[model samples]
Target: MTTAPTPVPSSAAADRDSTRVGGGAGGSRTAPKNPLADRTAPRRRLRPAGGPWLATLPLLVFFAIAFGLPAIAIAIGAFTLSPDAPSGAGSFTTSNMTASVQGAYSTALLGSIKLSALTALIGVLVGLPLAQAVVTSRFRMMREAVLSASGVLANFGGVPLAFAFVATLGNAGELTKQFKLTSHGWSLYTFNGLTIVYLYFLIPLMILTITPALEGLRVQWREAASNNGATNWQYWRHVALPILLPSLLGGYVMLFGSAFAAYATAAAMVGASIPLIPLHIADALSGNVLVGQGNVALALSLDMIVVAAIVMAVYLPLQRRSARWLS
Candidate 1:
């Protein structure tokens, strides 16, 4: 070991110096790059998230086929001039709409509005109390029974409901026979009679709709009012009525729409004597009364849709206000 002190090679000494610093060309080591994060491939931006419509794709497609196409055809047909004339000869015009708002057609629409309004009014007057009674009852069985009945009756519309009413109150119906209603100037086919029949369903529907809102009335609110020396009448008039008003109005609008759109029941019970819009629509479509006014039928449908849209516009705001308490 002492022999010449083991002389080291110059190149190997320089290599050791470089290793003491860093193993790079200029002794400046570069940072290691991440294979994933430092990727050179251009990043692909993500697409915007889709809406919830994918979940309703099937329903959308079904409506497109069932309702959408039919609605478009009706709109086109309504504007089509001389719809009764041969195809390719017809052109677009608003004459059908003009005709719809004139003469008997206008009367029919007004009649429909009257019937719907009367039914809705009566339904509210009768049904609100009935709903309140049921919801506020201490007897659970009675509440269940009434609610159950309402559920069934609300859906029990259309032809069969009409027939049932006829059998019970028609000219030769059991009630008519027993009570001799016809002799008392009460016929089951008049506008008033149709109104009576409509109540059978409309009242139940109101009961079903308003019951929840009635239940939403907190007992504590009444108690608080009582503690403040407020009478029951005062509490209801000031506090409860305001809260319930929106729900009541909303229910009335719903009933109006239901009655307005009703066809099969009215048709079965009274034919066309009532001059209801639905009856007029039927006549325009098939009967020789309107003859070649099929476009008028479609025009009438458009008017109905417009009315429905207006009803909903009024209903939505009322519903929003009601939901503040009842939801």
Candidate 2:
């Protein structure tokens, strides 16, 4: 070792030699390590992973133009006087809001709340058992038919169902003649009668909402509970109820919202006689005598806001509970 050990070529030099060997002698020397290549490396750059954002763009645009703009316009109108005033002199005012909150609107709002609460209660009572039956039944075809029918009925709200109820059970309805054999006859125009109609849709909604929760329950859990000598009631009360409670509450809130915001059904059943909040709002908008009719849009939007707030208030807690239960 007379001379200092020759410096060993680095791994970089080896890689260069390998590349040169791979290329022919006449081939251009491997382009001097592409400076931009490392920076623009495909493995390093984040890729745009497309998803629902792109898929739902049309829906987002439609909602923005149709609902969002109109809602804003209404909110602005609600804060200003002179319903017809377009531009000059009129500015933000709270008087209209005050009147809306304290006046006839208050009574209608209370009534709507009461009706919605009652409807939700009735729906839960009716739906839970139906869902349990559907889930536990041995007859597959019958269960499917029942579920399908409930789904159809749930969507069959508004005008057509109203007419069907009217024709079958209204004052001069066919059902009235059939029931002449018994002294107790039914009326479709009354509050209770409208409740019955609401329940028809409400029960189906409950069934649909509760079915998933019921199906989510494992047979093993039930069997294990039974093996531990738990009675049906005890098992349901201690285990099933806790698991199902959040979903049940969430379903009730949904039903309440549906019943509270209903106009067409109540309108068709009782017309102006019942004076539901939605009906009142509709009347205010359509009535020629009402000076602030144009402002009804604001009123309706406010009503919707209140309902939405109530639903969220009820739903948020249940959602948390549901998440915990699932976990």
Candidate 3:
């Protein structure tokens, strides 16, 4: 005969057995229920996949109209013959591109490069320490004052800036006359003067650019360095500088582009005396010195575009790297 099955435990008896086993070491405790754990919780409505893209539509449209169309026009004009050409007017040619890098145009391109490089270098050298000082300081008012001033001064360029410099340091200005700066080899219309003017804005721009990077330096890094017997100089030389290199380089490139593309101030102050690419472009398009050089102007514009594209190529990567580290 089959053995009789053991009697099944009742639900109450099973619960009592579980409680006794679970409470052997300590009393059994009930877990508090979370109000949001069940179907009563509010669900977040799903957003359409295209909603974010639609918000960016206006910006895309603006860029296409303002930047894209002009760029396309410039590219087309750079290859097309000027109407005043002796023959083949409106026809496609590379002569404009060829001419853009020859003789005076080449010289102007070199000059612009030299000027931009010099100013960018100087801006980095000065601005890095200045930004560090501002970031490390404890004074809120001073920081705000400096940042506000920088924001205004960085945008203060072109005609009015040139005029301000002229009135203060020009040959006939009161300060220039009183100080005899003209006799002291201080001419406001020279290459050196342009550099000084460029620095006025470039230094401020550098401060603004590198401030966030400086602020990203965590206090714990310093503490870690200190605990590891690293001196302040050592910490900066090995740790901080390496982390900040990308941001610094990016700022330099930005300043280079700014100085490279500057037009109005150089035109108003130095005129054709200095062979800057921007001034040359203005002259070529305006026909002030040579008529029918529109294509040449367009070619110069293309050269600028190429330079800007290279800068962007270098900058975007550096910016991403900096953001990654800082974040």
Per-candidate count of clashing residue pairs (backbone under 3 Å) = 0, 0, 0
The alpha-carbon RMSD values of the candidates against the true structure, listed in the order shown, are: 8.2, 7.5, 7.6
- Residue pairs clashing in model 3 are none
The sequence of per-residue lDDT tens digits that candidate 1 reaches over residues 124-149 is: 99999898889879999989998999
The residue-by-residue lDDT of candidate 2 on 1-327, one tens digit each, is 587888999999887777763365676466457878877888555755676688898999999999889777778877766546454325677665665665567777787788889999999988999899999999999999999999999888898889988888877778867786225745778778888899989999899999988888878888999999999999999999898888888998889989988888888778877757787677777764475555654655576676778778878887787767665
Candidate 3's C-alpha runs over 4 A off are 1-46
Give all candidates' CA lDDT scores.
0.87, 0.80, 0.91
Best prediction by TM-score: 3
Residue 53 of model 1 has an lDDT of 70
Clashing pairs in 2: none
| Candidate 1 residue runs with Cα over 4 Å from true position | 1-67, 86-88
Ranking by lDDT: 3, 1, 2
Q: Which ten residues in a row have the lowest lDDT in candidate 3?
A: 39-48
What lDDT, from 0 to 1, does candidate 3 have?
0.91
lDDT of 3 by residue, 7-124 (tens): 9999998876655534545766554557775645444344556887899999999999999999999999999999999999999999999999999999999999999999999999
